[model samples]
Target: MTKIKTHLSLAVAISGLAATPAMAQDTWEGMDTNSVRGEVQQRYDAALAATQDPAYISANDPRYIWASEAKAQCGIALGYLKSRTRDEVSLSKCRMAYDRMMDVPRPRPVIAATPPPAPVCNRELPGLIFFEFDSATPGPDAAEIVSYVTENAGPCNWSSFQVVGHTDRSGSNAYNLELSQRRADAVANLMTSRGIPQSALDTTASGEESPRVPTADGVRELQNRRVEILVNN
Candidate 1:
């Protein structure tokens, strides 16, 4: 009698499994982790309804029992797998955001070295022309100095000339002033004769106000009685 009852139970379980829709088989494939979990739960519920056996072992088929046990283990493993995936995705996004916030070094501007400024001509004639005591006239050797200035003025790039006259303090201030003016005038005339333009020449008389060598009130200094020529561009 017990054997007959077991056979009847097996026959009834077989009929129920045969009636199960084909869509339930392999439904977990191509599903996301959540979808797979939901499918497994649905299958277990359906299997439970078909039989009274708690192990869901129907028709003596071990596949259903295996699937039931596998699903439980899969649920735990899927939870940890999903957690790791979420953390990895978040880490990737954070790294990208940090890179965007960082400053990218740009190419620096190439600075060309600046060439030195061209030399400007601000020079004086090579030598000073000295005069005799109380004399405004040029000595014989003074012609050579004048010639040197006139010859090199254009080549030296001199744009203008300044002729300054000086004298010793041996004479009265008024007489010295007049003598200095005469001396400047003489130099200016000589420059003009040598082809220096009158427009480019300037003349001044200092008398005994500024002397080359300091001396007593009535002292005569040969260096003080002189004319200076300056060139400027």
Candidate 2:
């Protein structure tokens, strides 16, 4: 239960910021009044299991860090839910943390055969890596996600990659565009350092134009602050 910085959730103090009904609903996914605690508890159980999972523990999987973080955040939310007054903000943070872990699977190391055939997989491999608001530098999960993308690229025989960056509508249009591009470059640069050719990457910045979860012009929706790595063979 180490205080791992849960990026977007804690990047800004939002005690005074009350989320609108629409925004909260979208952000919470299915954490409604009826089953909020039940749903969160389910993810908490899964996160707890991940911490001790040999697939992660034995091989030092990077995702284990996220799982551990999710467990802590979710645990906090569960505690708050038990109190007389529920903290909506904390619950939102917990849900977002759990969402990050939802798609990621346990690490499975591949052992190459002596004379294996050309690497290929009949499937698509895409990645969405979030960032702290207003910052171009990658966050804690950057390296881990980059590694995941690169590992899958080999099997997909990737011909090209789309590295598009986005930002929550918190700043001016002009400034946001620049920030988004910088974020794209940050992720693209990681790929280049990992040996993914620059020419093969098509980078673009959506700024506040394309948000995962739309909000007001000045809203700081954590889910909108992300870079999507789209892969194609």
Candidate 3:
């Protein structure tokens, strides 16, 4: 009986050892870490090449915006690994080499910064008029503006339009800025009430500083208290 028990234990141990290779194969079949590392290196090289030439940088700039965030993640992984395996002296040398490479700056591509196209007023006159002196409530003149927009503005092509409200130089700059943003929200709400989709409009505010007409410091210009519309063309 003792001999039989010992043989049974030996058999179970042998069976487990036999299954180990199959389990390892199953785990490694679909996931090749070395292959993934090679592919990541290829992408990093390509991104580095793009950053070299001005034209390529303009067409495919990885510094300003990532071509693939995954590739940048791979770079971070490589940097971390490099920092780990080396001795302290070697690690410091590697860091200095990386810093020197990064310090070499490249010139930006020469592209004309053209102004955006003018807003298509389309004879609609403006809509959603803003109020002056910390008031969001639209007055009687606002009705005319709303009517013109409803009657004449053509089919909305863009997904969103912006309503930017401004305030005259009156109160604290910060307070006026917040007030201006509220005014913009009020105008956007007005537009939503007139059968336009609320999802298609956004609001922003520029306080006393960004005035339509330049004024002396602390001058409360009524003309500066207005709202402008911008369409995503």
Candidate 4:
């Protein structure tokens, strides 16, 4: 029966999860005057401490049954010690119970580090540059908007840019087409002057077509005569 109990105790301790004893009881340091009592007391304290380890605390399947067996063995060992009986078998069993619990691996905890926030660009994009009637210039007001885009371009991740020019329905279709190209060129030049890369600029003209305000032919609409800065970041 004792051999069967020992095998069962070992099986539970092995099946449950035993590890390098997490935190041993301090009583291991203080030994009793009698050799048998001191040994039993030491092994008892150690076996109990093994069950309290972090790895076994949450997963207590093996700890409870094995700890009960260890306690019973320790109790028998203690009884033999009190009677001054030289029962080497009981003492050996107590040692085996304690040693069985000292063998499993524990999983350590891991901590994660927090990452920093990314940079953000608050400037408005797809900048509009309106031209005066019959002229290609974007007017002085375009300077502030261009400056904003130029300075914030890097932060805003602006890679490619398109300067699309448009004309109001006033001149002949051929004349308006030529005028729109000139207007697009003028805005592209202005952007390049403001430090925008020339290689990144693309110009397109839509003359007297796709008007913003939708005006009839020969009408001069202020909204239609403009170039737009389209950012493709």
Measured on C-alpha atoms, candidate 1 has an lDDT of: 0.55
Model 4 lDDT per residue over 4-112, tens place: 3544565555334322333223233444439558778777776656544444433324453455346445655565566665444445556655665554444454366
Residue-by-residue lDDT tens digits, candidate 2, 1-233: 12223322332222133446643554545455547677778987887777555554333223555565566556655655555234565566556556666656655556754344333222332556677667888765568667757765867677689899999999999999889899999999999999899998989999999986669899876667788888755
TM-score against native, each model: 0.47, 0.55, 0.43, 0.47
Off by over 4 Å in 2: 1-125
The lDDT for every candidate, in the order shown, is: 0.55, 0.66, 0.49, 0.64
Best by TM-score: 2
Best by lDDT: 2
Where's the lowest-lDDT run of ten residues in candidate 2?
Answer: 1-10
The lowest-lDDT stretch of 10 consecutive residues in candidate 4 is 116-125
Candidate 1 regions with alpha-carbon error over 4 angstroms: 1-122, 125-127
Clashes of each: 0, 0, 0, 2
- How far off is residue 62 in model 2, in Å? 20
Which scores better on lDDT, 2 or 3? Answer: 2
* Model 1 per-residue lDDT tens digits across residues 1-233: 45335544543442233212342244334666666445434543443332223223222333332332233223222333344322222222222222222222323433776444222121533335667778889754456556657766776677688888889899899999988888887887888898889998889899999996678879876657888887756
Q: After superposition, how far is residue 155 of candidate 2 from its true place, in Å?
A: 1.0
Candidate 4 runs further than 4 Å off: 1-125
TM-score of 1: 0.47
